[model samples]
Target: MIKHRLFWPTASLLALLLGNFIANPGFFAIELRDGHLYGSLIDILRNGAPLILIALGMTLVIATGGIDLSVGSVAAISAAIACLQISKLGDQNSISGMLGAMGIALALSLVLGAWNGLLVAVFGIQPIVATLILMVSGRGLAQLITEGQIITINSDPYKAIGAGFVVALPLAILIALTVFVLISLVVRKSALGLLLESVGGNPEASRLAGVQSRRLIWLTYLLCGLFAGLAGLMLSSNVSSADGNALGLWMELDAILAVVIGGTMLTGGRFSFGGTLIGALLIQTLTTTVYRLGIPPETTLLFKAVVVMAVCLAQSPAFRRKVLGRRKPKPPAQASQTQTKVEIPA
Candidate 1:
């Protein structure tokens, strides 16, 4: 069962980590300084926190047999709104102001989520088509919010949310881990996980079984939006600026890949947070490796694509069978008997 659940992804992650360590012995080295832990592994967790959050939410949505192409756009918009709010405040660096901005950003995310849920759940539009509508238009909305320009700020309190350390761990990592724990508790410690699996396995059957498929589906998208919103804040806060045009570009694709590599089927059903976490780490490690190796920009993408293809094929049963060869069938009883009789006569 353990092997069935997360063998490939976990092994892949460990292999990547080992490779990184081989390339640089310092990769796994950790040191303490003034009550803070610092290292390459810590950097990976901090830098990958946003992707972890996005993928965490994506897991739930995909579990319900749906996709959210608009998550990247939602992230952009959330960053724009939060930055705009912070920049407008009289005390821009105040913790109160930052908190307020965060609240407003999260509220907007909920609204955006509801809009998506309405399009798919109420209007009965296909999930991909519905999300595509916002995915295409959300950037424009973000652009308008930022007035077609980047909004920069120098707020220490806001910066702390993304870049600060708590108990020697990054604040962003803490936030992401907190959310991960809460979600795991809610989904696993209750009946919610089974219900989501049911809905994804067969919506009609789930509905017949009295699972509120529409409500659950809608809620999953909303949660996804909320997670994206938090990620946007962490992103903008890290840089202390909001660049709507560039912010969160193609992150949805990364999130989906993380979900897929984490052992979550694109067709939907069972999901694994542990696998998602490992997948996110593996991706971040790969990106770090490319930079560390000084790979040229033109060739970097190709390298990544090849690696991703390998991982996908590794997860494919058909590919494994083709590569590893299938088991040979046993000889027929009649053939064995004839061979024995002939050998005795000889």
Candidate 2:
């Protein structure tokens, strides 16, 4: 347990939860009311659902030796597309209308993702640089979609995606969980996970071994874009509106942080879906804890930084060795004196 990659992040999340429970006795209390379960824990999962999705997607991309810096922008654009389409509907309450809007948005997301994949995999551009181009232009495209205005709607089905409850659990949480499980099964049950790690660990070697490295890389970016779109949908639906400028602003940072906290290396290779889940919950809990404890809003970023740094340091082998102070062996005690048999042999 001490040396496992999951040990530190899991410990950190539990410690945070325990501290909150200590500070507020009801932190873990869940209540059943109006056919819905409610509590601090529920809120964390509900609010962190989008983050979990994006982090999962980011994990895949990072595992393929690539990064998607345009997730936030892509999310904003997606929300704008969905909301705008729904706003134009004559019957906003129509489930079919909402589905159609979502389809259009998700399709656009895939295209954008494919564009990014093309840049990085086919054109041989740096992942960061390739994604950056979209990162800069996506916001403008979102504005264009929304005509520089916030698109609002009154579709219950659409709202349900983000805020509704299913079997007393938030629907958002269920969606994220479902996606996580499906993705996990797909990648793990087959050779896909190993292939991704191989490509990430050494692209040239993977290629020489007959792996289609570029296709794999492109696939990961496409997945990232798709998840970012889903996240945008949940975010905009929660508020029943999409403000292109603010829909997914700065969310890419949180997704990246969550992936990192989950023990996925920025350099790519192996990854942990379970770790990303815990990391996402930890981040959401931290934010809630800050407000619950009455910390100044201005210092929220600082507080998060401290906690993240502490957890990362806790996970570091060098840091642990420094703190624990490795004791040098007593030179095996020199056996004090050799037995007389040694002298006879000489």
Task: Give the best candidate by lDDT.
Answer: 2
Scored against the true structure, residue 17 in model 1 reaches a CA lDDT of 84
Q: What does candidate 2's lDDT look like per residue over 159-193, in tens digits?
A: 99999999999999999999999999999999999
Give TM-scores for every candidate, taking all chains together and pairing residue i with residue i. 0.93, 0.94
Q: Any runs in candidate 2 off by more than 4 Å, and if so which?
A: 327-346
Per-candidate alpha-carbon RMSD to the true structure = 5.4, 3.6
Residue 327 in candidate 2, Cα distance off native in Å: 6.8
Off by over 4 Å in 1: 1-3, 328-346
Cα lDDT of model 2 overall?
A: 0.92
* Residue pairs with clashing backbones, model 1: none
- Tens-digit lDDT string for candidate 1 (1-346): 4346477877778888898888888889999999988998898999999999999999999999999999999999999999999999988888888899999999998898888888888888998999999888998999999999999998999998889999999999999999999999999999999999999988888988888989998999999999999999999999999998999989898899889889999888889988888888878878888888889989987897788788888887777778889655677667444443445554
TM-score quality measure for candidate 1: 0.93
